[model samples]
Target: MGGFLSFVKKETLHIVRDRRTMMIALLMPVVQILLFGFALSTEINNIDFAVTSPNRTEAVRRQVERIAANPYFTFKGYIAPNEIDNALRSGRADAVAVFADDYDRQTAATERGEPAEKAVQLIFDASNPNNAAAGAGYMQSILLAGRQTGAAAPETRLLYNPQMKSAYNFVPGIMGLIFILICAMLTSVSIVREEETGTMEVLLVSPVRPIRIIFAKMIPYFLLSCLNLVSILLLARFVLGMPMSGSLAGLVGISLLYLMLALALGLLISTLANNQVTAMLISGMLLMLPIIMLSGMVFPIENMPGILQGVSCIIPARWYIEAVRKLMIEGVPFADVLREVLILAAMTAVLIGVALRKFNDKLE
Candidate 1:
């Protein structure tokens, strides 16, 4: 017991005195959150479009005004009838809406119970899927609503992000995922590094129990992760104006629990890896890839093929990402996230057990 306490003290001292550990555990998450929030976004806003109306009638003018007034669109000067391809190729236009010379004739035909004699040409840039989809949806909604009620729908409901902003969704999950990467995989490599440098041997030869050494190495990381959670939430609220829909305390509790799981995973990897370099390589390829790919951080799991969806079930980050989004975006109750919390708890238990068994074997 005395040996364990002494080892814990020594471990704490090592962590606190080391600048690299502090930077990895704390600074990395902050930088990643900011970078991803700014660079990676799904929200399509103020997309430029070209309009070419050969007839330039009053109906076409009204249609152009409608598209221009929408928050999702910006008028990018008129395009010649033949310049639609050029405008799209030069990246000057996301879409082009062309009104036929007899557009009034079509409206008149429909009103007069006759066959429509004209149609509008909508040329879209399909490369930017989100923008294209938004542009199409906006055009469809405007025309449908105007033809029916002459206004936008007042009953529209956005399920997750009411503002339809990408930052709100991506930042929360990215923040959680980045912390997992830094905390779990990096901590694993750090412990293995000590072994490579002979520091682990020096500690093992001392009076410390293996359990104490493991827990001590993990304590600083745990604290750092908690601090990271607080900072991220602050940034999301203040910088990006994202609201936390669930209880802050509950979210914090879950974050700490996930951090512990990450620490155990690190310890498990540390025990298995022959050296620090191998540990980092293995964790990055094996653990990090699955977390980033399967966690639905950037890709929707439901949209993935059946085999990949089945594989995603085993990823810890998927649960963590889901929990974070639910808390931050959906404002779900603690009870709602209970199943995910339980699954995480079970995974932590297994990792800790595996780590302890491996450490025992190494000692023997």
Candidate 2:
């Protein structure tokens, strides 16, 4: 009994002495609560909107004013009918309200107990299909309310994300979470463990090049991460009943690219850490938390503060998640996700180059 008690006391003291572990234990809950509390929200607001009227009649003016007055929309004022497409393509507008010259005439006809077709058109930038669908729905509700008489509702046209399923948003986010957590945390801890046990010094003395050694260690984990990716996709499909609407080959290729980026990031973390505990803390607190909170995994980047949205730009998970959503949910071709693929590729190259440079410096 006394021996057992002494062992417990000694272990407790050791834990107390380990500042990295102690700090992680103390700070983790606080950090998670603050991040999740502040960042997680589904409520969409402040949607950018453009208005175009062929005749600019009182009815058109009233409809525009009503839409602009809504809390969800930020009206960018009237643009030329020709400029509406450019505005959406340039990301200057999320939705466009186009009123035909016959809008007032149609409304008058409806009021006079006659069948009339309303010429109000609502066109959405379906790039983020979820937001586009939701915004369009809200606008439709508003238009319906404004129709005191039996007037025809506005015609809605969706561009890209037509289904607007919540699953489409979450599946890609889950992929980002799995890849980053598995690749970065696991690799960082695995490499740092050897350093703590003094085995890294022995390996460094061997004929094997340090870069090669790093790659050899990472290859198995990379394969394991791939397996995990497949498992996740299976579960998402069969269990969650989510549809994979995109090309399977494209999804796999992009996922592999993201996996490499994550692995490279893990190697970067390992290079900075002196021990496994530090690596774990850095991966969990710095990498995992941001991936969840700032990477558009749990929160919409558009709803975030401008500064936080800017911060999300640097998170590789953000790009990958967006790419996967576009591909898998929207069934977009590889050409559509080209920018995301290129960004991940560039980031992977930079991280690998930097990690190798640092490893060589350490070897010297």
After superposition on all C-alphas, the RMSD of every candidate to the true structure, in Å, is 2.7, 12.8
Worst 10 residues of 2 by lDDT: 28-37
Task: Candidate 1: list runs displaced more than 4 Å.
Answer: 1-21, 108-115, 127-131, 148-155
lDDT of 1 by residue, 1-364 (tens): 7776676676667777887866776777677777767776666777888998888888778888888888888989777988999999999998898888788888777666677755577889999787788778888777655545333346688886877777776775676576667677767877888888988888888776767777877776677777888888888888777888798888888888888888888887888898978888878887878877777987899999999999998888888788888988889988899988999899889988888899789767
In model 1, how large is the Cα lDDT of residue 115? Answer: 79
In each prediction, how many residue pairs overlap at the backbone (N, C-alpha, C within less than 3 A)? 2, 0
lDDT, candidate 2, 220-308, per-residue tens: 55766676677666756675455577778888999999888888888889988998889989999988899899999888899999999
Task: Compute each candidate's TM-score over C-alphas.
Answer: 0.89, 0.59
The lDDT values for all models are 0.79, 0.77
